[model samples]
Target: MNSVVRETPARRELPLPDGAISYLEWGAGEPGKAPLHFAHANGFNGFTYRRILSGLSDQFHVRAWDARGHGETTLTADPARHRNWYVYRDDLIAMAEDFKQATGKKIILAGHSMGGTASVMAAAARPDLVRGIALFDPVMIPTAARIVMLMSQLLRRRGNPLADGAEKRRAVFADRQTMVDRYEGRGAFRTWPRGFLEDYVEGGTKPREDGQIELSCAPAWEAANFRAQGHNITTAARNLHVPFALVRAERGSTCRPPFPMLLKRRDPAAHVMQVPGSTHFLPMEFPDVVAKEMRGFAARLEREGR
Candidate 1:
């Protein structure tokens, strides 16, 4: 008898007007197997949720993607590329367009951390494409990053002091084993699971003329993300034209709850779920909880989802 080895979803890179977008899809039938589209976190790629797909395969056709400038995706030379945060949301809209064309199913949009912000905006912009929202602490901050966005550019105008700081951000190990030992000794995996640091080490670096690898996205890019995170999702929530839910983790400084509060304050019908034991990275930490909540939210949207 021959043994069959199950293969992971063969991800295809899509050519967008801006650049190539990397995404994964897993399903057994058409309509992308009852779609659920996930926008991943800041540091990791879409593959981080492979286990969730394995668990939810019976229930949903799960899909996720790497955000631009993260994972194995390419970066554009145009400084004007990231001028408006809506560009990121538009990318999701384009993906949803392609998704609808291909699967003919409504995509339930979910995102973790900063990706959550993009997901929310996209859901609001195209309610017809997105069925509902499942946000994991959508990087919901009180203020929009308008002032700091200008200041960071001003500092660049004077002098790009931190222009290449990401290049300087390197970790040295006595040896491979020593490095592994160090991370394992500490609770880094407990904090961040799914062999994600490898993506940072891999996607975050490029081959230099010398034997070293250089990170393409600068430290300034990360800083600018924090600055852009100032976009008030409260305003974004008011613009939502569809059913939505924001799932917040009970622990961690990174968790933001005000997003759901803003939704509820604007409309009392929105749903907000908070899991007691998880951290900022709830889907990766509590896949079962995430899967269950997603099913309930989706079902309620049809029946009881307010």
Candidate 2:
């Protein structure tokens, strides 16, 4: 039986320009406990990982934020002006800095997919604020592919399949159950464990003035995130000076070949592992595994006095 106390995280918001960055926090502030900030994947909210974060609450101060254009974050998300994922990196850096100033302690940065990639970038840029990093199948495209995508962006070409799909995704639903009924066991959500899907629906949607619930992340902005993949994550990974751990999915992983290999080569101390029979949604499918890895990583960092 799982003995970890699963506390319902408290919802909070960090003020930012034009809007606030909404977040969910767990664990009481205990002396000597290192803070861990978890970022969510694109189109997902912080509440989506409540089980994992809540489980870690006993060991570390756990907090997860809804990125701009996702969840209840009121940040300006003009897809037309968005260029790359750097905005996410910058936002995360700001949050880390704010947390550090408030608590007077360095933080552990962790995330899934886009959130993971952004955490890497932020850690590389400001390692002083981050004690360590934990990533789950972050989207690290090959250098060649990044170059090709850069060229496409430079040419102003649009219409990525992922982006197109996001744009066409159903945005409005009568209620949470209706949304859950539509996404319970289909497509990318097929591997999601029970209650995770319901949490996603709860956090990923908002009540509109029309008495209907709609996706908190606008379809256009989600599509924009899919298209804006020009950031240099390889360089960011290579520049890590702090301890880090990476969990890769066995199937449909965005952290493709050569990236993880090269990351290990650059930082032999970096902990990288691939879970068998796991998909990109590994955290959702195997929350216990993800939580265990995170707790172990954070424990190591604490033992090292980081």
Top candidate by TM-score: 2
Candidate 2 error regions (>4 Å): 1-5, 152-158
Worst 10 residues of 1 by lDDT: 158-167
lDDT (10s digit) by residue, model 1, range 1-306: 111113366576778776788777777364335678888765456766666654665667766776776655663523334444565687789888887677777788888877788888888789889878777767665444345545766686542233233324444444433434455424424654534444334434545665545444444454345434334566677798777777788886244445566676754666677888877867756777777777777777778533
Provide the clash count, candidate 1: 4
Backbone collisions counted per model: 4, 0
For candidate 1, give the lDDT of residue 263. 71
Instruction: Give the lDDT of residue 21 in candidate 2.
Output: 94
* Poorly placed runs, candidate 1 (over 4 Å): 1-7, 75-84, 144-168, 171-190, 194-220, 229-232, 253-258, 265-269, 304-306
Per-model C-alpha lDDT, please? 0.64, 0.88
Kindly report which residue pairs in candidate 1 clash with one another.
143-230, 144-230, 144-231, 300-305
